[model samples]
Target: MKRRIAREKAVQILFQLDVAEVQLPDAIDMVMEDSTGESTEFLLSLVHGTLENLPAIDAEIQKYLRNWKLDRIANVDRSVLRLAFYELMFDEATPDRVVLNEAVELAKLFSDEQSYKFINGVLSAYLQAGATTTES
Candidate 1:
């Protein structure tokens, strides 16, 4: 449930980014002001870091997205991909399986039924494609 909370908060923060374009610290303070949880920092870091490196992250996602662009994807699905893809690509402390699983769960909660399968497939492909390049 810790990851679930983190994922939910991350989604909200990512969604907020589209409208406000505020800095992460300010955004984090705003988000945390109303919410209480153990996973808040983790979510904030994930959301902020991912936003910082979104160009690279979206490039990676685009590499595996076939025909889908980040802008073309639904907000919830895009947020899930951004968080999971960031962790999978950049966060050495988090395991690939954990990122993929958490992303699928987030998709299930925030997106349509088909989104769960789509997210799983995209992330699975991402892991498979990335596995060879990872030194860790």
Candidate 2:
């Protein structure tokens, strides 16, 4: 699968996990059903890695959220942030800009009009703070 498609799928699976409380493996299987000849490995990595590091990711997002609480953020927007933040913090191979752009794009597609701005602002803040560069 194209990385964009995989990323979008990752967001969807993440959203499903949050709202439906689906098991990780089951969620992966469910999303993969419609996909064929598309490498699921990347998608699975994003889903599992984001879930594995959710607490830390949420904490990072909270720091940049300003006045808004985490739970008050839209589920789709939160999922997009979580996935992008995972890439920013852990996937060193992909540049931060790519992750941020993809995340904003995903936000545009999956979330409300104003959500992209909020997502972009929060991510830009996270990057500017260099919060993930020293992750070890």
Candidate 3:
């Protein structure tokens, strides 16, 4: 599967985990029910890494929120941000622009109409601030 597909699946699983409080493994299993491929590895990595480092990821996102609180952000938007932020911080092989674009795409697909703009702004701010995984 394409990375975009993996990302979309990751967002679904994350959303499920967030709303239903499903266990991480079960969430992954739910999303990967009909899939079988290397793409699943990437999806698993994304979900596990995001959840494992959720606090740090949330804090990173919180810093980029100009007037908005992290909690005030929509769950779908938050999950999108978390996945993108994880890539920015941990997956250095992918360029920042790709990460940002993919994240915006995810927001456009899974979130409310204005969510993509909000996600773009926050991610742009984070890039401008020159943050790295080590910093926060």
Clashes of each: 0, 2, 0
Ranking by lDDT: 2, 3, 1
lDDT of 3: 0.87
lDDT string, candidate 1, 64-116, tens digits: 88788778888778888888888887788877887888888889888999999
* lDDT of each residue in 85-106, candidate 3, tens digit only: 9999887878899999999999
Query: What are the TM-scores, per candidate, against the unseen true structure?
Result: 0.83, 0.94, 0.91
* Maximum-lDDT candidate: 2
State the lDDT at 8 in candidate 2: 93
In the order shown, what is each candidate's alpha-carbon RMSD?
2.7, 1.2, 1.8
Score residue 66 of candidate 1 by CA lDDT.
Answer: 74
Candidate whose TM-score is highest: 2
Residue 117, model 1: lDDT of 95
Error of 3 at 2 (Å): 1.0
